[model samples]
Target: MNKKRMLVSLVTGAILGVFCIVGASIRSGGEASTSLLFALWYNRIIMGLVIGLNISKKDLPSIIIRGAFLGLVVSFAYYASTGFTDIVSFLAGIIYGIIIEYVNFRVNK
Candidate 1:
């Protein structure tokens, strides 16, 4: 695995995780449970790890697809855990995945 890619992805995850928390708080009007918030944050972290560890084709198209796929798969866990009620977050996960991979590609290139 590429350490640079991993590091970039992880950092991206951590940053996005914070954003996820903020978004959740706003969406729930600060009424979201702590556990739910934590899960949402951790979900992004896991997504990052998965994306970072993924050793796939280096081309841009391949990277974007892989990122989207990984994000969708990883985010599904959290989405499923919530009984599929948070469609917004589930969709955001796919976007975040693409962002993470695109950032990694740019930074590591």
Candidate 2:
């Protein structure tokens, strides 16, 4: 339970969540529903929190895999909620997961 790692991850998630919202709006021609925007933002935050709390191998490979796995799992909730229609977002979740973990690793190094 490294507080620094947790805080970093949470901040990363929050930042990335904003990006997700912006991307969603652009993709939807600024017509994306409010709920959808909030969900995307919230999902990243949850992903960050989960990744922050998870204790994975120190190696980069392990971190990447763990991040991707956690991303897929956490993103699946939103994907399923959308009836599995938003494949891009689901995939982005995996990438964001990797990014989050990599950032954590580098920053804490």
Candidate 3:
């Protein structure tokens, strides 16, 4: 990826990481587990990387397909690592991909 794209991914991942931390803290009543926090950061970073790498200045359909596929791959890896299946996470991944792509599109433009 280009330097600009990398920078965008990093920034987006960091923003998502912060959101994950805050969400986890709230969900756990301000006592989130270290592992949970770590997972959140890791997942967001992966998603950002995948979205940044796959998306391009292309047609909307192609962009959507690429983003959705990459998102599924990342989400699958996460679920496999944790030895659990979460429908929410799976769906979230897809949504995250679209959101990331949209953000990149807006930023790049």
Candidate 4:
């Protein structure tokens, strides 16, 4: 990806991470959350959407498959960087990407 797109992906991921942190804080009765799983879940969806923007309609399906894989890899790396080891975090990232895409399609349709 180009620098601009990479920047967008990074920023989007940061925004999503902020939301997940906020969500976790609320879920934890306003206590701050220092959870890597939440961060992984957020980054993957944002990365998927970033990659999706570069895919054409004819290649969308295959591209999405690759995008999901990339998303998982990115999330896993972030998790490792943050000292996370749960495999569930990677799975959650994949599920979140599919769910988010499905919801976006449903709404736009």
Local lDDT at 19 for model 1: 98
Model 2, 11-85: lDDT tens digits are 999999999999989988999999999999999999999999987457999999998999999999999998999
Poorest stretch of ten by lDDT in candidate 3 = 81-90
Kindly provide the TM-score of model 2 when superposed on the true structure, using C-alpha atoms. Answer: 0.96
Ranking of predictions according to TM-score? 2, 1, 3, 4
Write model 3 residue lDDT over 10-84, tens digit each, in one string: 678668667766776776788867887788678978888767665366566766776677778777776676576
User: Model 1 over residues 1-109: C-alpha lDDT tens digits?
Assistant: 9898888899999899999999999999999999999999999999999999977456999988988999999999999999999999999999999999999888877
Model with the higher lDDT, candidate 2 or 4: 2
Q: Give the range of the ten consecutive residues with the poorest summed lDDT in model 2.
A: 54-63
Which residues of candidate 4, in runs, are more than 4 Å off?
A: 34-58, 77-92, 95-109
In the predicted model 1, the residue pairs found to clash are: none
TM-score of candidate 4 versus the correct structure, residues matched by position? 0.48
What TM-score number comes out for model 3?
A: 0.77
- What digit string (tens of lDDT, one per residue) describes model 4 on residues 1-109? 3444444445555555566555556655775445543654456546645554552323346545754665676666655765675445556555444444433333333
lDDT of 2 at 45: 97
| C-alpha lDDT of candidate 4 relative to the true structure | 0.52
* Model 3: CA > 4 A from native: 25-32
